[model samples]
Target: MAGPALLLIALLLATLGQAPTARAEPNVHIYAAASLGDALDAAIARYEASHAVNIVPVYAASSTAARQIANGAPAELYFSANERWMTWLGEQGITLSERSDLLHNQLVLIAPRKDDASSVALDKPGELVARLGAGRRLAVGDPAHVPAGIYARQALQSLDEWQTLETRLARADNVRAALALVERGEAPLGIVYKTDARASNRVSELATFPAASHDPINYPLALVGTSPSDAASAFREWLAGEQALAIFQDFGFAAATSDAH
Candidate 1:
C-alpha cells in the first residue's frame, strides 16, 4: 500500500511540474486615424513578431479618436491624421509624451476606376462644377471636424470654388468613407489622401491638389497616458525609426521633414 501511494504522489507531482504556466503579455492600445489602418497594421504585425507585447489598435477619424481619448478611452498611444486634434488633446490637459510629426500626405481628387473623363483642371474656374454635373456631389470628409475634409475645404477655398461646391458636397465620417463613396459610384468625385486613393483599386486618381492650397498635411504621433508602459514607449520609438519610415513610404506616405509643422 505504501509503494502504490508513493507512486501516485510522484505521478501527480510530475504532471503539475509539466503543466504550462499562464502568462499574460502586456497590452498596448493604439488609437489612430482611419487612413493609417493598413500601414499601422503592418507595423504592428512586424513589431509583434519580434516582441512579446500584444497590440490593440483602434482606427477612426482623428476628431472622434481625440474626443474619445479626452473622454477617457483606454488608449496608451494616439496618432492623429493632423496636428489639430493633438493640439486639442493638449488643450484638454491630456498628458502626452514623445509627441512629434510622423508623416506627410497629399490631398487628391479621385473618381471611380471606370471613369473615363479627362483630368479636370482645378485651377480652371467652373471645371469642378461642370465635372459634377447636375445634382451630383463631391464626396469628402466632413470639413467641420475631419482633418481631410478641412484640408479639402482649404484647397477649394484657395481655388475660389468653395462657395459653389460647399452646398453640393457629400460629407463623410472619414477620409476612407469619402473614398468609398466614389469607389461605390455613389459620388462622382472624392477628395482624399493620396495614400487612401492608392490603397483602393476601385478608385482612380484624377489630380493631386497643390500643397500650397492648404496647411501642410501632417500626421502627429504621441504617447497619451500619464505614464505609458515600457512596451508602449518602445513601440513609439520604433515607429519613428527608419524601418518604420520605410514601411510608411511603401504605403505611399512621405516622411515628415524637420521643418514640417
Candidate 2:
C-alpha cells in the first residue's frame, strides 16, 4: 500500500513541476514536423492553458528531428508528417510506444501570388517545368530525407516531370523552408503542404498533386524517447483526442486515424 501511495504522490509531484527519484520529468517536449508548426503551437497553447504541465514543442523536418533523436535528443514525443520516418525510428528501437497516425494533408505546388501568372496543368507532364518563369528553380524539401521532398519527387516522377526539373531543384531543410523560399520570392515555384500555403499570404496554390502520385500523407504521432515519462503519455493522449483534432481541422488537416497502427 505504501509503495503504490508513493508512486501516486510522485506522479502528482511531477505534474506539479517536481521530479521524484525516477525519471520524473515534469514536462513533455514534442519534436514535430515543420509543416505542423503553427497548428501545433496553437494546440500547445490551448493545452497548457488548462493543463498543469508544460508541453514544449520543437519543430523541424521529421528527418532532422528523427536523426537528432537517434543521436539521443531529449524530446519526449515525435509527431511526423510521413510514416516512413516514424517507421525508421521504430526500427531503431527508439520509440517508447503509442505510435499512431493523427492527421492527413494534401501536397500542392505553389508559386508567388501574382496577377498575371498563367495556371499550369498539373495532370500533364512538363507543365510544371515550363511554367518555371525566369527563376527556373523549384524549391523543395531535401528529397533524400524530408518527407515533403520525397512526396514531391514521387509526384513529379509519376507525371514524368522529375528529369526535367531535377537540375532546377532548390532543396530546403524542410517543407516550410521550401515554402519560405517561394514566399520570399527566392524561388519561383515550390512544392508544399496545402496547410503551409494557407498559412502564408505571399504564396498561392498553383496545383495539387494527385493522390496516386505518392504515398498517403499521414501525420503519425508517437511517444519517442529512451526514458518516457507519465506526463508525456498523458499529454499524448490529450493531443490525440478531439481537442487537438479540432485545431488540426482548422488548419486544413483531415482526420486519418481510422487505420492507425
Q: Residues 1-261, candidate 1, lDDT per residue (tens digit)? A: 999999999999999999999888999999999999999999999999999999999999999999999999999999999898999998999998889998999999999987475687989998888888899999999999999999999999999999999999999999999999998999999999999999999988888999999999999999987889999999999999999998999999999863322
- The per-model lDDT (C-alpha) reads 0.93, 0.88
Model 1 pairs in collision: none
**Model 2, range 51-82, lDDT digits (tens) per residue?**
77888899999999988888888888999998
TM-scores, each model vs. reference:
0.93, 0.87
Residue 46 lDDT in candidate 1 = 92
After TM-score superposition, the amount by which residue 211's alpha carbon in candidate 2 deviates from its true location, in angstroms, is 0.7
RMSD after CA superposition, every candidate:
2.3, 8.1
